[model samples]
Target chain A: MFDTERVKLLAERVRPTAPSRTRLLPVLAPLASLLPDGGLRRGTSVRCGAGPHGGALSLALALAAGPSAAGSWCAVVGMDDVGPLAAAGFGLDLDRLAVVRSGPAHWALATGVLIDGVDLVVVAPPPHPRPAAVRTLAARARDRGAVLVVVGPWSADHELVVERSSWHGLAEGAGRLQARRVTVVARGRGAAVRPVRRELWLPTATGKVAAA
Target chain B: MTALPRLLLVECPALTVPAVEPGAGGDEGGRRLRLFARVVDALAEVCPWIDPVRPGVCTLPIKGPTRYFGSEGAVLARVAEVVTTVMAAGPALAGEGTAVGAGDGAPPVPPVPPVPPVRLGVADGLFAATLAARAGTVVAVGETERFLAPWPVDVLGDPDLADVLVRLGLTTLGRFAALPAPDVLARFGAAGARCHRVARGLDGELPGWRVPGTSRHLLAALGRDLALTEHQPGFWGGASAADERAAEVLTDLQRRLGPEAVVVPVLEGGRGPADRCRLVPWRPAGTSAEDDRGLHGRAQARGGRASEPPWPGRLPPPAPARVAAGGTGERAGAAEVADGDGAPVAVTARGLLTGRPARLSVGGGPWMPVTGWSAPWPVEERWWSRGRRRAARLQVLAGGSEGRAYLLVVERGRWRVEAAYD
Candidate 1:
């Protein structure tokens, strides 16, 4: 294992940089494909679809489970539907979750404050947020090395977009509503230079989310 | 060698307020505490050993400070004068030149409110010092016995213990303290014993009553590690300063917004998404971290559980991130339930399910028909309780071209999407 290439890579890793902006955070194994780096890239933003109550919220919980379970603090701001029972079921370590349900006017400000200490921040963007304000929060998240997950009605500068989500468990009737299979499309002008598409089960029948 | 330490208790009114309405007494007490803190911080040049007991109540051990000021009474007068000056000059000190008839173009400075009553009590023990302050009097050194004798036993502040003492005809502190310590303990219990101790002015010489964080005598009380004792009083000052500042900022934020505005979500055991977690006010530095450890050990104990068998019907892991406990909120989870493209779904008795649901097409895309599905998992919870619940969890694959899936639940005889697999 003592090779010149390994040494060179190790040297590059140790090279000095702005500390917080470079910290890497974990994402659930199933949600890896949704990110450009196959993991939650600190200081970047990702947009996911808002589902029919359980849709986006469940996926967001699954995405946050990896980092939160690994002891990284996650904050869900302006999101109320995701109750503690659902959050706990998603394998999210509840001890580390800070749900900032502050009003609409204070969501962005609360997100900014939270990003400084937490590893991941999932927030529902206000109905109409000015581009400048969104950019400021993204920049701040990047500066603080936190992953910013925007849920619901957002179309702007994001590193990736996980959309076109469809529920998988229920049929017309006479059956149990169980899993969900969603389409993950990568679209952004940043690291994801080329668009990539992948299909996934946000959660399988066993109550676990995994990539297909 | 001399014995007990002299303690001063500063008793300020409006320390605690009753909750009458919005922005009521409790919050104003906090504001008053900050004003008191500001006054104390300004006087840090003289009084260094100040310890806050509660909002507007603090203990100032004046033994060393009195040495510099010449006498105990002199020290008291100095503090009173400082309080008067600060109250009078507060607005003038607040910048912006906003004063009446100011040359600068701005609104006039408001008239300063009259200073609140402050009682200064000097005694040998905390209980006695507090009592002395509340009475707005000072007990001369070693005359604490006579001063305490005439007061009612109710001054102990334990109403239950005082009640029994009154019934037993031990009407005054002197009569109460006259009883043998062993007899009081056998008769009245722990609180009564504590009352007996407070009555006797023996607190200053008591083993635990020494001035905290001081000279060799105090260090000896801590079982002083002689080698590490000297010159390290402020060892953790720099680190603690930043931590304290962070705590202060969070405390200020909690005050500005309603306590619920900032919350820390803690997971508790429960059967459904609604019962599993609750919000507690957030503190950047709180006992919550340690509290979570205890919660982790007792993670199985659902919040507010009474005497009932634990319900085994719990939502499986990979809990939904957002569970709309109530069907309606800022973000509605599953308000309307239908089967197979806007068609209502019905769950028949004996665990059978049948219904037609609506189709969902986002962005004007073609409707994805939910084609195939599995059996219904019906759950009836808390049958023993008055508000029992019944729901059937279902799973189905929706997309025709692509095999997409979603999780739905039929509760209260209606079907709504609970989660999705994608």
Candidate 2:
């Protein structure tokens, strides 16, 4: 004597008012168009890599900047020499940022612990990471509603690659470095199946992200 | 045997209360105890190991704070600054006449008491440090005996022993210390023997010097126990629910991976990206709430300013994303810069490049063409000191304009990759 219609109505009434909205973490305005939902989706893992010319670390820091500025606790693991000044330049709240310098041996363990509590974790995974560790980390992030941004190769839900980058304001025996423009390509498995490309300044003259 | 710990003793003359009779002076004594508690609380910001010796005095081991603040002189200056600010703000915080009669409607503002000066001194041990504080001088290392030589025996706080010593022609500590230890022990018993050792600067403490239950008295005055029972979440800007959660895992990770494995960034004034920011070990809140509050208060004060204090030679914004781990030559990768003729490039004494950098190699890596580079920026640090360094920096663009960028530094004819714009 199960009534399918009544059950369906009850399920709708108990569901979140806007499930997608609550699940999304804000991103910078210029980088929003590159994401499917215009923000980082919680519990999702994203992989970011740099081209031969570098911008991956900056881009990853920029992505985390959104949540960190929005009062989320962010931990950067395996990046021992991460420049906090550059992170601050990218709009991260330095007060809430913790840098965990875990060696390759404890990289997975550290990231897993951080994922259990932190809102966003940007980790540089060790080379040849164990598949089991990767699976457990992704599962933990999902279960804990944390965002994982990997700075290396991984089977991620979304992938962002710095397709190309160029530094501006320097010449042979001339001016100092001032800014960098980059092309970031975004692709994912679900709604973002189609690849997306965006051109922006990874860091402008004032050390903040802006549209190129 | 390990050397006696170097202690910094701070004495507030106005707050000292007689240990023999508790609350003898009634309201005035209680007020002094309350004010002393506030002083101790404020000094906790400088270092957490402050030991309240009695009502008006405290001592802290200076070694740890010296290392953190860079030098003993700096620590002394900081302690002086903190104590002065606290003393200046004491009366208003303690409330002028509120304690006299709480139920009285709008009690008249009582006359403000003059703030007493705080005495700061450092020496080898507690006894010597206390004397040093009274004299307002620092006893040089291995010089405590010399510093204590001229002090009268009466300062040891034993009237009967001091009277007997004076009658025996041992008026000064130096004279009394000259007596053989066995002779002194044989002549005067245990207490006199201990006092003789203190005079010689061997022992740092004496019986009855530290008043028991001082913390209990302080707690009674402050109306709360010294140890906090629970943490106040969101007590500061970053202390939100998310912060509490993050702190839990971070602390757990620290326990597992070791404390040094986890760090939080502290921005400071310096010329280079690495110098501008420092990574310090993360400490859980509440356990050291005063320390955190002090640091955050300083940061917030800086934030209230118009702009950061300018470093004349600091690289223009757009700071490098990845700075080398160590300072100067420690972790920087060796780099070779060559000109179009393949000759090694160098920076001259006048800070001009001897040759245009056309190629570069880092850490024995494959050589990349340096398509573009900036003029050298000269850096002369600590020039007046013996460890002075003269170096030059160059911004090099390798591969192409859109290729990799590096911050290259040359010191003593050697070059290294100081940072990357990755």
Candidate 3:
């Protein structure tokens, strides 16, 4: 009994804007268990830190391998420790990585601009931002379908955390240094509510990451 | 930055040195390039991507970013605003390493001098845009040929190629470009073919990548491979799988993510991480790094400079991951190096290790430390030049276990990490 034109107009007026859905990005086999859906989720930030020895850098590079291999450009901002050659050793395609070494002050804004086009954004954690600033950056990443990987001691309530890292290879004081294995613990944050736990070698003896 | 040319005379070229030396400083355009590049980056705040044509020239594709503005003229006004601000701010603010925010709502920034000479041009192709920019004229969208009709043929940069047309009494770009494509290709060869394409407002046809010295050979190969269909057997007129598929994917991807998204990076042959590679904008399919640079050998042949001499005492492989790239890439803070024992070692002016740190274990065996290290080799080139050259290069390679080595540089009384052996 309703007029067709009136009904169509009512439906259009009440339509809900769908949440942006980003395609899953590739993740290295070693750390696949760390992320939800066994892949690097878009619009999400996964946190990592330095291992007992020196595993933080090795782990960060491992996270980049998958997406860069998938033809997506990745940028590492403010992490002065890692360079193109070391990244190349970790199996990252240097051509796809644009390293922007900005100071602590400009990290958030520079990262926001990079996320617009870049698929993956890795930043060395700066001092915790005010809540409003964090929300703004998170919103930008979500809108652009970019995944932010925060390294170092980041203060934001991160969805994923790879903690209690330990390095193995060198005997008490004799043999050569070799691998990094860490326990990746995940927590529910924002609207996403789910937890995960897994163990993996951030880098094997061959200088590449794989299952522990 | 040109405002501080007197500062540059002090030999502190800093980050803008790369773009500044050859383009602006080389006496070619006598224009501000560092300012031009920064203006483009600043424009990216509103406009998505801009194709930089050289030191004095660049084009913003208004069709894309103009949607955010009320009209195309608004977008042009915003670009012109950035150009004037960057140009007026001078080169110091252009600091190429980090992009400082182009804040709209600012708590007082530097004063911007009035810029009246900055020009913007709109047209069908980049070449036309450049011409219009030079004349400070905006060509209508569809009337590129008409706009170009009255222009002289010498507008083409290549004089040898343009002279043939001048001799033929063809004064305008419209007259030369209107000739048969095949006849133009046959008469003037490859370089002329490019000029003809530009004249015809078909500037989009030129290869996107910067053509190095191997260009003559690469151009032929590109032409031959583009239309080939030998791989696909069934189709009468089809492209082969490897050749066309790569180009097709490259172009298709470029369309979606802007031109800067898809690039071919070429590493030039040289020492020093920063000096080793030059980034070329475009790459042909199946282009190997070995074949990437044919120009370097020719330049070397002409100059036979010592810059490329085998740096014997230079650092080993596994170069430092980050070179700051602006001002001085090496941070003044992270300049110290540690020995095997995790102790900081003092490097004497003679480039010798003053106090060797404790011998710690290296993966395979006990670390064997060197009793004496080599002297710091000093490199000072172009002592007479007022600017645009390295004043000194201090290199020393020492330390590490059996398989590991460290290369360090001492510049301006401060130490720096250059490269290291794996």
Candidate 4:
């Protein structure tokens, strides 16, 4: 006969885990030092708006390097308007990148596929983001161990406004280096609203981010 | 292998299921969801022999399907037949056209045996198939490399492979596939090998196929004078000897193979009730597709959306349904009823019969009678109007398997199973 008592005693009681702590992923601020964490944490989401010379794309490039540097893959989903030339200007290595132009209608499906295996997924939020849908995806990202970055202007009516753990506002361009600087607003648990200014720089000699 | 006519892979999406609408016509999230489900279902219906159903911007592998179907022409016919039947029900599905694996720079291969109406293009391989599908004409074998040449650098768009190819000054599919396998691998590793294989007319991996039993479709043609009862037995039982004037058509189906198929019942206002829009796959022991045709034919003749595809999976959890729930509340159960204290019972006997029923028993508290219920809560946008919103009316909080709170609401009496703690 099987030892039921011993088996029951040996079986560990499962416990529910609390929601993981949120971490701030840093983008290069034109006027400030690199972010404290060096990069965004896995499973975190952020929103950004572009300045005169495409500040949003610039910030994405800085984050892309973090994963590509580790030889991992990164994908951009649901971006239709961003031209290839503009993407290249931000010094993003196209070789390590996969851009999905799903247009506006199929953004959700594309987002679902991209977040499955990629280290980082950058998406432009739906025209009208459903808080419920976003939350579902956020939870999925957490489960899959992937980072999600929402790029575009903030919507007042969006159900979930993935609050900024650290936010950087790009400033107007001033020079060839002008494409880099931005003012960041930071706030969240264990975070403060530091009105810090930072400068952006491209370390690659030819001013182009080489293919990763 | 050289003597065998080059094989072409053609994929036709179900017309009845468009990409944009999950639940179209009258359903929420319409058409889009239905299309995806139908594609999966169609693949399931033709499985084991079809092998693996690959979802990509590329054509499926032809090895397993070709082998099982006995001939290349037979496989093409089977694919076309499924697509044609689906088209009869709704929107016309578009075929992906033909793709061939001709060695580089060869003449276009002609379609043999059963011919297709859609213009087809044969290419040296799958990559060229995708490119040829766009042009409406098939690219022949042997000419794949030469034909793929000069199509622009952006065509080889996979970043890892494309960038390497561009750097090597090899922009076209022909040039990329022409490179020595060893040199390409030495320079680009596994990705280069893949690019080379794709450039050639060969799949990097040989996938399996799972084609299910054939779906049998039944058709019924009847005289205008025929009564609904004459076909009731066939409709419900899926087969019957009805009036001599009526004819039935039957088509075979593989899975969920049974008679008593799910049928969409008409609710008030000549629309299909949510629960009634279901069809069982397999018929009963004695019934066949012939019986199904008789049953479905009568339903269509009576002015309704004819039954076509099989039933879908079970619905998500239900939402609360209150046609008229209203009032300012102050009492303990006042909010539940919503109509102040002692309002007339909104839970009418007829309402109880027409709506989904739920039983609630209060314990450990003073049991107060539900004196009255009122307020047309969350009246989902009036059904007559187009572009109505699907909003649930109730605010429910349930726990998941992990004991996490999940916020769910019923909009318009339809329950949408929402995410946990969401």
- Ranking the candidates on TM-score from highest down gives 2, 1, 3, 4
Model 2, A1-212: lDDT tens per residue?
A: 97999999999999867766567888889888888888888889989998789888999999999877877889999888788888989999888889998888779989988986788999999888899999999999887778999998789988899998988898778887888989999998777389999999989998899989
Off by over 4 Å in 3: A1-22, A51-54, A101-105, A152-178, A181-183, A190-197, B1-422
Q: Model 1, B1-422: lDDT tens per residue?
A: 12334678775553322211212223332344345555555454456545444444556668767887998888899877776565455433222433433453334433333425467888766777777887878888877778888899877767788888899999899999899999999998765776787788664322223222122121222233322311121353422332332233233233223445656655555555455555666654423354344344334344443443565755554445444534312232342334645765567766775554445332245555556655666668677998777776655555563544544566776556554443
**Range of the 10 consecutive residues with the lowest summed lDDT in candidate 3 chain A:** A169-178
Best by DockQ: 2
TM-score of chain A for candidate 1?
0.79
Top-lDDT candidate index? 2
| Model 1 chain B weakest lDDT span, ten residues long | B16-25
Deviating ranges (above 4 Å) for candidate 1: A1-22, A28-41, A49-59, A83-91, A153-158, A163-181, A188-192, B1-257, B264-270, B277-318, B327-344, B349-351, B354-379, B389-422
Q: Say which prediction, candidate 1 or candidate 4, comes out ahead on DockQ.
A: 1
Model 4 alpha-carbon miss at residue B182, Å: 56
lDDT of 4 by residue, A37-129 (tens): 445666666554443223354455455655544434456655532322223334333333455545565466556545554556777777677
- Backbone collisions counted per model: 51, 1, 6, 106
Residue A154's lDDT within candidate 4 is: 31
How does residue B104 of candidate 2 score in lDDT?
A: 36
Model 2 spans with C-alpha error above 4 angstroms: A1-7, A190-192, B1-239, B289-307
lDDT of 2 by residue, B395-419 (tens): 9999865689999999999998888
Q: In candidate 2 chain B, where is summed lDDT lowest over 10 consecutive residues?
A: B225-234
Worst 10 residues of 2 chain A by lDDT: A16-25
* Share of reference contacts found in each model: 0.48, 0.89, 0.12, 0.00
